[model samples]
Target: MSLLETLEMLSYLVTIVGLPLAILTFVWEQRKERRNEEEEIFQRLSDEYREFLKLVLDNADLHLLRREGAQTELTDEQKERRLAIFGILISLFERAYLLVYEDEMDKQTRRMWQSWEDYMREWVRRADFRDALPGLLEGEDEEFTHYISQLMNEEQKVP
Candidate 1:
């Protein structure tokens, strides 16, 4: 074929093959970027959880309060302390529920939530926590409260 004709055929082949390849590469890159973003979010949430747990574990009173809660009528100061602790816990759970609801929680992220879920189950049973629940729920995100409610009921149903 003449040089012009050969050049035209090459351009046609590129349009047919190269365009699709380019499009696919672009899509693959986008998927990779999206995965990286999800991973970063998951890591940040996980790190925050770990650090908080470490802080509680490192403190004797905080650790006791978290594990057994109040065994008797608490003074106003104790009540306030319990409220603050639960406030932080519930807020973290709310953020996590939102992340999962927003489709940001991958398999690893969901797995990371297992401990939090277990804690929720146990926390809901605490007398101090039960006392605090009503006030805590009053201002929480509706969907997050609903999620916790389901967990609370599930824990209740178990023997």
Candidate 2:
């Protein structure tokens, strides 16, 4: 073959080989970027969940103290504080739900999410958590017990 023709054929081969490699590199980088984003989201959710659990536990502690025949009366101010904290807890749970059950979430994480939701609903129902904290808490010791168990389960995966 002529030298020019040979060179042209070699250039064609190079293009064919380089195209897929370039495409593969682009795909790999895209995947890595997505992975980094997902990791950041997971970490943020985990941290927020930990903080939420802490607040819930604190609320439970206050409830437990009152349940033990220790000053069960909650003033309006105290009730407002409890309501504020509980509302924040609910918001955290909603965020965590979105995080853990995001479109790409794996099966195990989805299962944990189902459990979390069920536990939250159960506690809310048993204690009528939507009602006035003072009156509900005075007679809702069992709900606190259930809450502790759910918190333990939720925190089990944390380091």
Candidate 3:
């Protein structure tokens, strides 16, 4: 073949080869970026799951101690300490629930919370444990009452 024809063929070959390599590089980079994003999502979820478990375990410990009447044998200061622990447990449970399920919580999450609610109900019904819970439930009742009253006031104002 003539030298000009050979050069033309070589140019065509380079374009075909270089175009695919460039496209392949772009696709590979996009795939890598997607993988990194998935890893970040998995890491965030793992951190959330760990926090949830910690809250559940802390609540269980505090609940069990109060249920067993271990506080009665201790001094008043010890009783206060136990109450503080119970308060911490409740606060942690509330915070974790809000973090994990801000708006649309899943069924498994609601089921987990329901289990905790039933346990709390049992605790509230126990005469010995009732005193331990008044602190946790007291502020909540007033908040609910205020919310209901505000709704009523707003309705009256409307009509």
| Candidate number achieving the greatest TM-score relative to the actual structure | 1
Can you write out model 3's per-residue Cα lDDT over 15-96, one digit (the tens) per residue? 9998899999999999789656644644565565456556545655334434445543566665665576556545544443
Q: What CA root-mean-square deviation does each model show from the true structure?
A: 2.9, 9.1, 10.8
Q: Candidates ranked by lDDT, best first? A: 1, 2, 3
What local distance difference test score does each model get?
Answer: 0.72, 0.58, 0.53
Q: Tens digits of per-residue lDDT for model 1 on 1-159?
A: 999999999999999999999999999999899778767776777787777676556544534344466456666775666577677777877787776444355576567566567767777866566667778888889977887888777766776
Candidate 2: pairs in clash: none
Candidate 1 has its poorest 10 consecutive residues by lDDT at: 58-67
TM-score of each: 0.79, 0.55, 0.38
Report how far residue 131 has shifted in candidate 3, in Å. 1.1
* Candidate 1 CA-lDDT value: 0.72
Query: What lDDT, from 0 to 1, does candidate 3 have?
Result: 0.53
Off by over 4 Å in 3: 1-68, 100-106, 125-128, 137-159
Clashing pairs in 1: none
1 versus 2: better TM-score goes to: 1
Q: Could you tell me how far off, in angstroms, the CA of residue 106 lies in candidate 2 after the best superposition?
A: 4.2
lDDT of 1 at 60: 40
Those runs of model 2 whose alpha carbons end farther than 4 Å from true positions after fitting are 1-3, 56-61, 64-73, 99-159
